[model samples]
Target chain A: MSRVHDMGGRYGDGAVNPADNATFAQDWHARALALTLAAGALGQWNIDVSRHARETLSPKDYSRFSYYEKWLAGLADMLVNLGVLTREELKAGHATGVSELASRILKADAVAGVLAKGSPYTRDGAPNAEFKPGDRVKTRRPAHNIQVAGGHTRLPGYASGLIGEVVLLHGAHVLPDSNAHGLGEAAEPLYAVAFAARDVWGDEAGAWDEVVLDLWQSYLEPTA
Target chain B: MHFRAGQTRATSANLAAMPHDHDHDHPHTLLPPEPALRVRALETILTEKGLIDPAALDEIIETYQHKIGPQNGAKVVARIWSDPTFRKGMLDEPMPLLEELEFYGRQGEHMVIVENTPEVHNVVVCTLCSCYPWPLLGIPPGWYKSDAYRSRVVREPRKVLAEFGVDVPDDKKVRVWDSTAEVRYLVVPERPEGTEGMDEDALAALVTRDSMIGTGLALRPEA
Candidate 1:
């Protein structure tokens, strides 16, 4: 939650410009996305790892770079850190030698099939959900204890520790906090917790507004 | 050698007025090469390293650029409005119907559909990242992924909605779904009145991309 990426209810921002809807503003954006995704298909890392790498950027870089720029930086870091490439190679803007990952390249023909068959996080053998719909519950302050959470968490700062009722139980899914690190996919039950806007934002919030978050069970307190 | 304060001010004023004060000496090569060059460089490096195929990259870009997009979501919304069975089916368990309709894949693996009604308005946001239903709606628009929309939408839905000219009534309970997990959401905007005679194709025409995202409503039929 302390990360720059955990932005919710922070103020002093301009309007949401509704004019530009082009998928990619520049020729490079499309290429950047494609390159990241192609490299991702190498099967070396998961989406959670990619997300953590992207957010792990410096605060200034996180805030300053355009969206895909951050993605490019993350991809470069991930490739280098994974030993698929080297810093000197990137600096030279050329490959010193062919990578061993050649045997695992994502061919053009496989792109459609791979995208169509998306990597679904849902898995079998989930335990019974602890809390049911309409049960009043509170999210644990996992973020406050950042050292314990290991830096990658799905629960944003704005909605942390808020008291809310379980609006829906979405069965069990991969826990991003653990999955992001090499901690393994500790699949846990996820629920939609609805917090009243008035409770979260106080007077600034509209009386009838409510925010619902899809939070994993690990983020919720054991008791109601 | 530096001049005294008063002397420097006069010299600076004169220099500012002068046409050639070292300005013409250097051509504007201040910027590095455009991003295109860097992007090409990266692509070439990866390709040469045998880590990626330029063809695959092209296929990925081409698919997103042409094959997938909001039009798919528009068609789904139209079918939802025109067919009662499909609307109920979609609301109850969207995956089956979406898979049948082929609006299933990629970032939209785990899908959820929320309907907007006269009494309740629904909107979707991802405060952490841009977790969108890409198969149905394509890549998210700039505003949808922006800080202003992400930070304030959950706390102040109406204000952000107003930014897109969508004014939720005071009596209408606004429900903002912050996609914290991988589940992606699509808002089935309320069908506008006076569209009784329209077919699904015609109805799909009325569905704007923003309507499916809950920032705006479907276009009303002409009077």
Candidate 2:
């Protein structure tokens, strides 16, 4: 679905401010990051789901909110929707003395261990890779009314429905679209699909430049 | 009267050094005036409910802020630059080498290192959200997440690079790696000229965060 988050190929936003590298400019920003990570570390919602929640914000709010602030809003939304925290609790800014259902909180000492042993999206699967490096391919046209249906996707708006060459075959990895919707790990072969600037953005792009996207096998079709 | 170049530089430097000169704006002021208080309230409530551990929260903050950052990746790049065998290992299978050096896991789990040669320059951007290799590059810079970059980098990488003062030759192919999947990419920037006698540590000093992102060239030592 078209959203503020999907801004690829669109123009006239503003100059890329190169000097703004500070991770957290305010005290609340750090708290926002911490709360999101802590709440997410629980074995409840998936990363894709959290991302979808973040994208679901009104375009006005999404545009206005800073990166961590967006995370805070999304985290709050997810908690409320999941029935873990009530709206009253959020408004009151305190727990309502109700029993909490959070069973697997990330322990302080184990934070480093857990982060060091990161989440790998790959899963052992049966589908063999359909394409190899050097194979010519075209991206599948994304379904237009996806936002109305309500879900998540890794497919960028710009390179969808475009032709490209397979540069590398990443072995079976979890499909984020399915994972976001609580579907089973629909693992599939992923590829680094390279599209020429001309092919992606017409004559405006540099003649020699190319953009490569890591596309799943399901997002591609064979081409001569 | 026209000011000299030195005076102009001094004036600009003085202006930059001045604090709270005109605008002392905090974005949080627009949303809620008491965000810090609100955050503190949430933290206290969550802690009381046992939903979050304060120590764990501190640990997470510390890791991203200090423990891991661009310097870790810089070491890896410097090693690769100084040693051909290491470079071959990195190009062939980078995951193991990065893991051996403890730069694996988190966003750095599934890794691919793209080399920058004289003929081709490699740049990385996540057209989606900022899905960078946190363990390798630390948290991504703010501009990386800006709409201008997310929208324009793919269509005008040369223009973007020019803004960063990196002028890729027109003849050289510019390959923009859009990180769309879980696998993260790290660009092994080409070593700058006139640093042949420098050690790996010295070479590491030349590696800036932007060079790894392909926005800027590696620093050149004094000739």
Candidate 3:
């Protein structure tokens, strides 16, 4: 189902705010960012799982809360679901005396190094790529009945079900849709698929413009 | 932005549960008044549970805040401007060329640096999500994540560029790169004219975060 987070090609009420960027506006924003990285370093849940937590939030909460606030909410929910913490503890905003499971902990000293050596999504010994540059392919659309309730998917909502030309085959890599759900590292070929603006958004788009998107093998098929 | 019946109920229940004000009319103006207090609570709870280390949190923040940012990208762009071979190498094998500058990891894992020439202008947006090159650009700006930017940029690149004060001529073609996967993009902005004698450091100073994102152009040096 389409969520507020999937607002691609969706019109908004006002003009796009072109204000300058700020790293963090509020102190809590920094805390939200830090806690996310620290918890992510524990090696329990993958980044996709974290994303799913946020995606499943009540659409109301999803749009109302700011970006980092969403991060906090997702982190809290995952902690409970993973048995790291309980719902009671989260509501109370403090740890209960009862002990919880602890498999691994990211130490303070290792934080910098851990983050510095970021987790690469690429996997080893993957199969050869199916499509190459200059190949014409069509984007695969998810079946209407298909539901992605609690998992992750790299397939963007807007780019789906369209025709495009393969621009570059980025050597086989881990499929994020599978990796995000703890479904093991299912490696596959990724490609940069370039679609003519008219093909994606109709004739309203500029004739000279093209939108290039990086897509996984599963999302494409040879265009007849 | 339509919601299901279940979602509607969930929202109502959530709103009722929280002892907070709701400004449904204007969500943009909504800011949690007591964010610091809530952050402290969450941090305290996690620390006590041994799920996270406070020191580690500090280090992570410090690194993103001070160490990594657009300055690092400016260095790469500067090298490209100064060394023709390096620029060619970037267009051919981006990962290896960028790694030479130690600018590879995180969102910067697989990059394709698009050069802006006299006839074409390039811009980037992750219509799906905020898939920016963090190692090179640092954290993305809030507008980059807004629905307006994500939706309109691909549809009307020329108009969006104008809003950023970047006006491409009618003859110039606009290319929008939508980052949909691990591969990221960094726009190699056109080198400003009248800066023919600037050193590498001086050239690096002209590259801003927005320039690399293709929303703005490189700054012209003082005459």
Candidate 4:
């Protein structure tokens, strides 16, 4: 829940640190790989379900539905295939107690552990950056094409070395870009910043233009 | 009914405006565009199969082409220019205030507004897909939707902006924002100078749709 680092990778020092060798030291990389593979599998499942749904439903109706709703439908099919949930049970639940069943099934804790092996859940020490609002900073561009298994790099082509003002700091988190996109390990100290159009584009940039980017702490370095 | 009739007339006129270059040395180029043929075939199949009623397709086209798009952005610009406090509120949390206006669509509930200042310029792109601030700006422009624009803009923004006729000095940095989540973005272009005495409506009139998308600035009133 916290925005820990900006590099979109997890790195910290502490007791039971997820990134460290103490707790998950032995199986950390393996867990990360497995989780990455699982994510890819789930992504494929989502694509399949969405394609089928698109074929069956109108675009308007499909747009109105949430990703979670589609996931639940897909989950039902998967559960039925595994013989974990019978069609009769699913039908009965949908008929009379949809809300209750959904609430119980969708609890965060239930699925939290499933991805713990790959998640950045370290109890590491707090971040070091003293960045405040109005401070000028530049995003650290990660190496070009430096691929990591199951992690995404926080180095977006658009964000590299761009000056921005720190807006809000979302405490330590697994940088979504790196973790989900297979760029790098999850890190800490994520801050969302707003960039002025002029700062980004110069005088020719419409004086009124600006953009806000969510950056992991590691991706930023104080600018002169 | 009048609007529907007008739409048909306008569509036909636009179609007629296309260059009538029927002859081509290359047979491949001479063939009708593949996408056009695919669309025609799909329409025939859908009609024959009764998969979608004719009225539904008409409604869809009308909603997207006429009902949705740049007007929504224009309205937002007008409101922001008219009300300074609303502009502040928009900068604070674009989603909540936007929802208050009740002008939201799909993928708009999580919205963020980035402002462009005299010293900085901002542009947005989605490398993975053509993610845009549809709720505020409506559909993205044709250039934003193109793969070349998407792939190159994020990497070489200065060069790309030059292509769009926005020349940034070498000293000025070009920052590109990538939308990765369901959240959408709108660029709040800075209010231009020399418009101090102008009324809010007049100032609003200066705010162009492209300004909201971070591609250009609002036009200033001539002296």
Candidate 5:
């Protein structure tokens, strides 16, 4: 088994410089445009009405709004601005019956143009070079540059290079490295795996001490 | 912008000593108090521009901040502590079990309750964003929102807990729940000792907001 080591460095140290960070932010802003288009094209508001109640108006109404909402909201705002639908139409459709209105909007060429551009969602992270569940694997301790309050650096104070097994695939999420820089960057495939106590801390661990973590696919390497 | 190697070393030492505190007076700086503020500002603009009725904005702000989140959490906690079958139901299939409670928060239709025991510890974070089990634990804490906690907690559970003054023994395995999507997590912390005979209300009282969020354990009567 290869020993995973965390060569200490700053968060966002390897992937992004200050310049790349700016670019990432700009990319996120641009992506917001596409997200709005997709939402409009899909008649997301109507979908919300059917799923939630009439009282639930904006998708933002959903509690626990996060970074994703910004993109969706920007998308909706653009749709209204593009003359795809009058704000009144969107609002009225939200109240009662809007299937016909939604159908018309969904068919609009302008709306189609925006949707055709497709999603600005990007995949930006290390590629996973490991196998699926039941495969024995170990976590690699790559030196990560993390930004702290007053400054930024990398340290291995945490459980770095701990061994575990892949349990579930968590699709793609915004890479932590991209997020630290406020770049509004893309997501990567992540996994949820359970690590046995003995593997992580040897005999010191309790019999039931099993650690579960969501690791980026890139952070893993297959064990022989 | 010069990265002095020695300065970096000193900073790490300082962080180790101080262990970043979340009790900053400026709470809003940690999480966006902006959503509410922005809603208000939008309402004001709309009102001035005659875009919306005055009452509409007020309702929006009220529903989101006060009515939506904490109420959901309280209901879920109450339901689990009171009903045994429901407790088992929750442990078995958390998502459907949560719906039976009939108190759903935004993004909380899907839920998971991770059990925390004497031997094992659990904590939740939304590394990419602040995804929390709002239906079961209420709005997340400021520390949960801080980039330091989000990035470090999943990777370094013990160190992160230590910063929060929660020193789990090295023998105890820490499970960090990384919430994404609509799925959220609530920590079913071990029901503290001394409260074995306490009523549901008393037990609920002992279940501090932090315990629900998985930071600290539920309170027990002093020995």
Candidate 6:
């Protein structure tokens, strides 16, 4: 819940810059994006795992790296952790020796096809939704169990422990909480849960405002 | 020059903003004042190890930079308005519509289109990370992923929307979609009253990138 990346409602950040619309602020931003996507195609890790890797970076590194820079750093950490490449190769700017596991390098000819044909996260035959539209529910506060305290969770700290209502049933989809830790994919029913902005932010929020979250079933508890 | 661990996420951005005073004190910037060089070095390492293809990286960049972007999303939103069949197709299930228009791709595989109306207005944000619909809207704008946005929009959507020159009246409820899991959201702005005669391309022109993200209202017919 205290993860630096779980940044919702934490204040003192300045105004949102609508004029700052550039997709990539620097030349390296483009490279960082492509490199991360290309390297990810090697089949060693899923998007969830990569996100968890990024979230797990030291707080200083997390705060220091620009968004795309974080992508590059996370890519490096995952590559080394997964043994796809070594620390020496990264530091030396050359391979000390050929990587033994060159399992599924994405080729130029196949890049467009691979990107166009994105892998769908919905598992087959998985439609056991427990909640329906208009059903009230409360986001489960993190239990803080010793075993499960510090892994990646999609539930933002601000919305946790807050009561909300299911706005839409999104069927079943891959759960990041389990998948991020190499615990294997589990498709949980995902719903759009709407929390009143006043409840989420107290009296300062607009009277008619609400925040909706795409939450998995495990993150929600049925409320009276 | 180690930043205190307690510095807010904006510290890096703040440091970047104040170049005259901060740049000299901090010799290393961008985590390596040479981000381009660092990226090049990583590419070289990956290519040499047969771990990646440089041309593939170029392809990825080419696709995002030129082949697709917010314009693709414009076409989708315009279609939803100009064509009732397309609108129903989009509302019933968006995948086929996305495919029919060739707007389907990564970061956009799982999409839920939320429509705006007189009673309620919807906006999208990613509180945990920048989870955006890449193929439909291209890479998200920098502000969409900023600490200010990710931290504030969900809590005060009307205020955030107001900052973007969008004002939701108190009578009109505002909903902010925090895309946390695999789902990516595209907010369909309400069609203006007089656009019934507007052709598809004409309608498409009114759909600004921010409009689809629910941060701003779609441009009026004149715009």
Which candidate number would show the highest DockQ if scored against the true structure? 6
Model 4 spans with C-alpha error above 4 angstroms: A1-224, B1-33, B43-53, B169-173
Per-residue CA lDDT of model 4 for A127-220, tens digit only, reads 6556877888887654222332312343454456678899765456444443332222244666667777556545755444455666666677
Residue A87 lDDT in candidate 1: 66
Tell me, by lDDT, which candidate is best.
1
DockQ of 1: 0.25
Query: Looking at candidate 4, what TM-score does chain B attain?
Result: 0.74
Error of 6 at B118 (Å): 1.6
**Docking verdict class for candidate 6:** acceptable
Residue B177 of model 6, lDDT score: 86
The alpha-carbon deviation from the true structure for residue B68 of candidate 5, after best TM-score superposition, in angstroms, is 3.7
TM-score, every prediction: 0.90, 0.89, 0.88, 0.49, 0.50, 0.90
lDDT of 2 by residue, B1-223 (tens): 0111121211223212222111222122223335566567667667766788888888888888888888988898999998999999998888888888888777787999998999999999987788888888888888888788888888899888887878988899999998888889988888888888789888888888888888877888862
Proportion of true inter-chain contacts also present in candidate 4: 0.02
Q: How do these models rank on lDDT, best leading? A: 1, 6, 2, 3, 4, 5
How close is each model in CA RMSD to the real structure? Answer: 13.1, 12.4, 7.0, 19.4, 16.2, 7.9
- Candidate 1 lDDT tens digits, A77-158: 6666566767677777889989876887899999998888777777667766889988888887745424234357888888
Error of 1 at A140 (Å): 1.4
- Candidate 3, residues A1-224, lDDT tens digits: the string is 46556666777634667784777766677778888777765554665566666765677877777777777766766565565666667667778863443334577787655654555666668877888899999887861112224345767677888888999888887676665554555788899988888887888887777888888888788877
Off by more than 4 A, model 6: A125-127, A143-147, B1-33
- lDDT (C-alpha, whole model) for all candidates: 0.79, 0.75, 0.73, 0.46, 0.45, 0.78
| Residue B127, model 3, lDDT | 75
Q: Which ten residues in a row have the lowest lDDT in candidate 4 chain A?
A: A1-10
TM-score of chain A of each: 0.94, 0.93, 0.91, 0.41, 0.37, 0.94
